[model samples]
Target: MKIDDVVKDTLGRWAEEATVPQGLADRALRRRRRSRVRAFAVMAGATATVVATALTVPALVQPSGGEAGVILAEGKPADDPAISLTGPPEVSADPDATPPTKLVATEKTAMYAYYTWDNEKISDTRQILKQTWYLYNPDSATYEKTPWAAVDVAAGGHVAVLEEAQARRVGLLGPEGQVRWIDLEQPASQLKWSPDGRKLLLVSYAANPNEQGVFDEDGSSREIVPVTRTGFSVVDVAAGQAFFRPLPAGGDAWGRSVDLHWSDDGTLIWDWDTGSESSPPPRRFYDLEGRPHAAPPDPADTGQEAGLSPTGRFSAIHSPDRSAIAAVRDTSSGAITPLKPVAGHWIEQAIAWSGDDHLITWACELKGSAGCEVSEFRNRLLLVSVDGRQAVPLTGFRQNSQKPGSWEPLFARR
Candidate 1:
C-alpha cells in the first residue's frame, strides 16, 4: 500500500484492530515496523526519484539510495482478495490525463499526498478494498511511494502522522523518512497535525473504519464493526507529551471515519456529527479537554468543508446556481459574489484557500450540469483566482472519478 493509502484508509482508516485484507496486514504489520518502530528509527539519508512533470520548477533528479524512501515487502501475498496496483494519470495540466501523475502547487499551498485504490470481491457478499498512495517530495518536486496503512501530512507538508497497528503509540514522520515515536496509552485510528505545526491530535478508535461487514436476515454473517470511539489526545509536537481526554461514545456507534479536524485558528478540533438523518451538519467544535465547544466562526450554509478562509473574512463555496459556477460569501455583509467563467465553461470548487485572493481548487473538464455531480466530474487540482479569471493546474484530471476508491488529494501549506 502507498504511504497515502497508508492514509486513504484514514480518508475512510489509519491503524486498525478490525480485519483487513491479508495483503494489507502483511504489508502494514511488518517485523521491522512492529519491532524496530519502537526505538528511535535512524534517519537514513534518501535520494529523490526523477519524475516527469509539466511544472516549470527547475527539476533535480538524483539516483536512488539503496532503499531510502522505499520499504520492502517481507512475505508473499496471501490468497484472499488479490491486489492490482494502478498509477494515477499524468501530473498537472494536459487535460488528457486523469488523477494526475505530476501535481504542482503554489509556495503557500501544495498537494502533499494523494491516494488511488482498487476493490476486489472476496465473496458474494464481501469485497476487500486496497489503496496505493503518493507522497509529494518538495525537495525533488516528485511524489514518492511508502507503506502506511493510513497517513496525514502535517500543516507544512514537512511531516506525516501515522500510528502503529495494534500498538499504543503514534509516529511523527519527518522529511527524510525518520520517525519520532511517542508512546500513547491508547491506539489512535487517525492523527491530525495542527496548522501551526506545533501539536498532534490523535483520534482513538476500536477498529479500522475502512472495513465493515454485513449479514443475512437470519443472522448468518459475523459482525465486522469494531468498538466506537473512546476519546482523543492532544500532544505537543516538540515536547512529545500527551494530554489524554476521555469522551466515550455511548450506545451510538460512531466509527473513526467521523474523523476529527482542527479549526482554522488551530485553537480547537471538531467533527461534523450526522446524528440520524441530517447531512452536511454544521461544525461541532471541541476544546482541548474534549468539552463540546462553540459553533464555527462562519456557517457552512452551502455545506462546504473548510469553506471559511484562514482570516475568517470570506467563505468559499460552489456557486448556488447550476450555471454561475464558483462563488464566495462576504462574511461581514452576507453578500455572495459569483466568479467569472474561464474557458467559456470554467467552474471552480474553492476548497483550500492560499490567502485572501487565491485558492487551491478542483478544475473540471466535463461541461454543463453533469459536471457539477461527483460521478460525472473529472477533476484536477488547480490554483485559481477568486474572480475566476486566472487558473493554474495543480494536478491532471482524475480517472474513474465515479468510483469511491478514486484518487483524493491531501492539501498542505508549503
Candidate 2:
C-alpha cells in the first residue's frame, strides 16, 4: 500500500481502538464546550479559515511539552574576515528620549519575535512576545526595530502569515494590513514559510496526557505525556487551501526539539537530527501529501548539512578554534572558502542566502571579562559576502538574562 493509505489505515485503527476514561471524557466535553463559546466570540468579527461546522481535530503532538527550542550545532568544516579590526561597531551611546513606535518599513528588513519583560520577574516564560522587524540604518550606522506581530513572511515582504495566539487561528496579512483568518482544527505552534514563499509548514501538538483535574486534590497526579511527532499541514497561500496528513505511525518519539528545513525546490521538508554527534542523522523527507519519501542519497557527511545554502552547492562552516568566523564548503569537492569574520565576534549559523554571493548569518560578540567563551556572548543578524570582504550588521546585539541571546532571526531576500 502507498504511504498515504498506510497513514489513513493507522489513524482509522487508532480511532477505533482508542478509549477515553469516563472522567477524562467528561473533562474533554467540558473543555470543548468552552472552546466552542470562545471560538464563536472570536470569529464574530474576524475572517475565519474554517467554518463552524467543520470537524476539529484534537491538539496534535508537538516535539515535547508543546514547546520547541532552538538548536545550534557545532563542528569544524571537514575542508574550511577583514572589514573591521577594532570589532563590531558599537550602537549609539545616547539613549532615545522615547522608544521608536514604528519600524523602518523596507523590503530588506527581516521580522522576528522580540520578547521583553512584562514584569520584573527574570523568567522568560513570563515575558511578553512582540513581533519585531530589524532594519539597518546607514546614517546612524545601527539597526533599528519596528514592532510587528507576524508568524511568517513571504520572500518579497508582500504577504505575511499571522497567528492569533489566544484564539488559535492563523491569518494572512497583506502589504496593506488586510487580514484573512484561517481556522485550524488543531492548535499549531511552528509556522515555516517555504523558500519560494508559496507554501507554509504548520506543526501542531498532540493532546497533553497529563492534564490536571478541575479541582486540585491531594495525590492528584497527571499522566506523563510522551513526546511524539503529531503531523504537519501544508498551506498554499494562493489557493487558500490547507492539507493536513497524519503520520503513518504514532509519530517519532524524539521529544519536542526538532529543526525543520525545506528543500530548495519546496517539494520536501527535512527534519534534521538534534543529537550531539558529528555524523548526520538518517535522512527523512516528507512530500506535500505528508507521505514519507525514500531517503535521498547522502550528500556529504560534512556536519554542515543543517546550514546548506539555497543552491545546495555550499554549506556554511565555522572555524575549529571558535574564532567567530565562518566559511563555505563545496559539498561535492569539499573545498572551503573562508569568509570575513567580524572582529571580536563569531558567526552563529548561516540562516539564508541573498543571491549566490552573500549569506545571512547570526554574529555574536565574545563576552566575559576573563576570556571569550562560546557560551557567553550576544548575537545580532548580519549579511556577509562570501569573499571575506563585506560584513553588514543588520541588528544590534540582543542579550537578556533569561535567554542565552535574542531569538533567532528568519531571513529572506527582496
Candidate 3:
C-alpha cells in the first residue's frame, strides 16, 4: 500500500492490532491523572536543538545496570526557556492542599522518577522555583516532605534529599521542623542522586535573566530578560563538591536546551547540536567530557524526542517514521542502531523505553491532507516492540488536539 494510504486509514479511525481490554481507557486515564506532575514536570524544561539544557530529574529513581547503556530525548525538540507552574506558590497555602509526601510506583523498578514542588518565590523576580527531583524505592511510594523540600530513597535503602543545597550538610529535624543540616544555599534546578545514592546531578543556571516586566495574555511587549544558558554539575553527595560541564562552546545549542537521561551503565545521553555553519547540521551524542561520539548520518534526518530504553543499551528517537528511532549498543567497539519504520499512524510525542525492549507511543490525529483519515480528531496509544513488529493499538481517546499526552512503561509488568 502507498504510505499516504496507510497513514490515512490509520488516522481516520482508531486502528490498532492490539485489543483495548475492558476498563483499559479508564485505567489509562487514571494513570495519566496520577502521573501528570511526574510526566510534565521534567518535560516542561526540555529544549529544542537550539535551546538551554535543563535537568528535570524524576522524584522516584530506580537504579539501572549492565555493561553499556541506552540514551534517549523526549518530545518535539522545541526551544522553550519559559517556566510554567501548576499549583500556587509554596508559601501561604492551606495546609490541607499539600499531599502527604511518599514514594510512588514509576513504570520500571529501575525507572527514572520525575516530580515537582512549588515553593514561594521570596523575590518577586523569581518564579516559585518548581524544583524537580528523582527519588527511588519505598521512599518513592511513602516519602514525606518538610517545607520547601522533598526526601528520596535509593535501592540500597539509603535516603537523601534530591536538593543541591541539602548536600552542604544534612541533619535530623526536630519535632518542630527545625533543620539541623541548615542548608544555606538556594536550591538547584534539576537535582537527582545517582543509583548508589552517593552522588548528585544538580543543574544550575549559568545566567539569571532580568525580568523586564509581566504582560497580559495578549501579545503585548513585556520587558523581560530571556533565560539563556543553563549549566550542569555532578556532585559527590557526601563530599558536597561538584564537577561542572558547561554549555557546549560556541554552539547554537548553548541556549537551545535538551533533556538528560542516564544509561544503565551511567553514561550521560543528551540531544545536542553538532553541525556548524561550515558543517552539516545534525543532533549528536557527547560523553561527560563534552566529546562527540554518535553523530547521525543525515543532519535533517536527525530528529528529536529521544528516549533511552530501560536496559540502557538502546535508544529510540521519535520522528516522522519508526525509522527515526535510533538504538545504540555500548560495547568495546560501540554500535549504532538505526530507526526502523513501524506500520500505522503515530503522534510526535515522547517515547518510553520499556523493560522488555518494547516501544510505546501516543499516536495523534493526522490531518486529512496529511493523508491519514483515521479520525479528524481521534488519538490512540501504540505498543510496538523494538524487534520491528507491526504497531499494535492498545487504547484510544478523543483527541484533545491541545494538551494530548500519553505514557510508556519503563518495565514490563512483573
TM-score of each: 0.67, 0.55, 0.42
Model 2, 1-414: lDDT tens per residue?
999999999999989887432123223333222212111111111112111111121122111322221111121111100001122322222112112212212123233222222222223222223323333223333334332233454554433333333225455443222344455555654566776767777665563211112212453652233444466667665555566666422234443334344555677875644443533345467777766776556532333312566567777665344333456877779887765355554555555565556666555654431222344244555566766467666556655323522344433334
lDDT of 1 at 109: 58
lDDT of 1 by residue, 1-414 (tens): 899875788856434556322123223322212111111111111113311210111112221322122211222211111111123422333334455545455555555666666655556555444445566664554566645545565544545434333336554554333444466667776666666767877777665444545455586774555446678888775666666788665224443325566766678877656473553344578888989988666633443333667677888755566455567777888887765445433444555777667767665654443243333255666676766677766666665454766776666555
In candidate 1, which residue ranges exceed 4 Å CA deviation? 1-97, 120-130, 163-167, 214-227, 250-257, 276-283, 294-302, 344-348, 366-375
Q: For residue 229, give model 1's deviation from the true position in Å.
A: 0.6
Best by lDDT: 1
- Model 3 lDDT tens row, 50-102: 11121221212111322111111232211111111222221111111112122
For all candidates in order, the CA lDDT equals: 0.52, 0.42, 0.35
Q: Count the backbone clashes (under 3 Å) in each candidate.
A: 17, 15, 58
* Model 2 weakest 10-residue run by lDDT: 76-85
lDDT of 1 at 119: 59
Q: Residue 26 lDDT in model 1? A: 24
- Residue 347 in candidate 2 has what lDDT? 59
